[model samples]
Target: MMALYNGDEKDIREFFRVYCNFFKEQGYDVVTFEACIGMIMPGAGALGDSRVIPVIQEEDDFRNYPWDDIPELYFKEYSKYFRALREEMPEGMKAIGGVGNGIFECVQDLTSFQGLCYIAADDEELYHNLFKK
Candidate 1:
C-alpha cells in the first residue's frame, strides 16, 4: 500500500516536494505514491481526486464507489484493511473493536444519522435503497 506524505504534515503540493526532498536528504531511494499516481496518470490533479484520476483502480475496494450488490465489496475490503491495521499496530496502539465500534455505528457512517435510524427501525427496503445497496 502507498501513503501520501504532505510535507511534515498534511498539505497538497508540499507532499510531492517533501517526498523528493526526503530522498535527497536521506541520500537513499524512496518509492512514493506520487510516482504511483504518475504511473497511473501524469496529469492527476490530486491523489484523492477520484473524479479526475483513480489512484486505486480496484473500485470494489473503494468506500464511496456505488455497487448493485447489497453487500458492497468495500465492506470486505475495509474489514480486511481494518483488521490488518489493528494487527500490525505496535503494542501501545493495539485494541479490539467494541460497543462504539460495532456494526451500527459503522453503518451510520455509510448511512447518515436519519438513514441509520431508519434502517435500524426495521425499514430494510428504505435502508437498502438509501445506502445504494
Candidate 2:
C-alpha cells in the first residue's frame, strides 16, 4: 500500500520535492519509482514467499475477475505518484518509473508459477484467456 500511496497529493508535493532532491543532491540524475499491480489484485501473494494460492485456477475465476475495474482502481491508487514524480523532477534530472507489473508478471502473480504450469497443461484456453483478460 505504501508503494501505491504518495500521501495526499496537495500535501505530498513538498515531500516529493524533498524525495527527488535527495537523489539529485547525491549526484544522481534520475529517481526511480514504481507501483505494483498486486495492490489492486484480490489474491496476489504469489510473487512472494507467502501462501502460493492462485486467484485464477479455472476459467470461471478468470471470467469472474473484475477486469473492468482495473483501470479505475489503478488510477485511483497510483496516478498521483506519477504526476508527482514528473512535477518534482530536479532540473537536469529525469525519472525512471513503472506503473505496475507487466502481463507476464501479473499473470504469474495471479496464478502461482506452479499453478501457471498446471494451467498450461490442464486448460490452455483458460490460461490464454487469463492473459487476454
Model 1 scores worst on lDDT over the 10 consecutive residues at 33-42
Candidate 2 residue-wise lDDT, 5-118, digit = tens: 545776567767888999998999888777887778777778664387788788888888788887788888777877887898888998887766788888888888888899
List ranges where model 2 is wrong by over 4 Å.
1-11, 49-52
Q: Model 1, 1-133: lDDT tens per residue?
A: 2443222222333443454455546554432221121222222222233244332222232334343442344343234434333333333332343222333333344444553564547665555543443
Residue 85 alpha-carbon offset, candidate 2, angstroms:
1.9
In order, how many clashes per candidate?
A: 0, 0
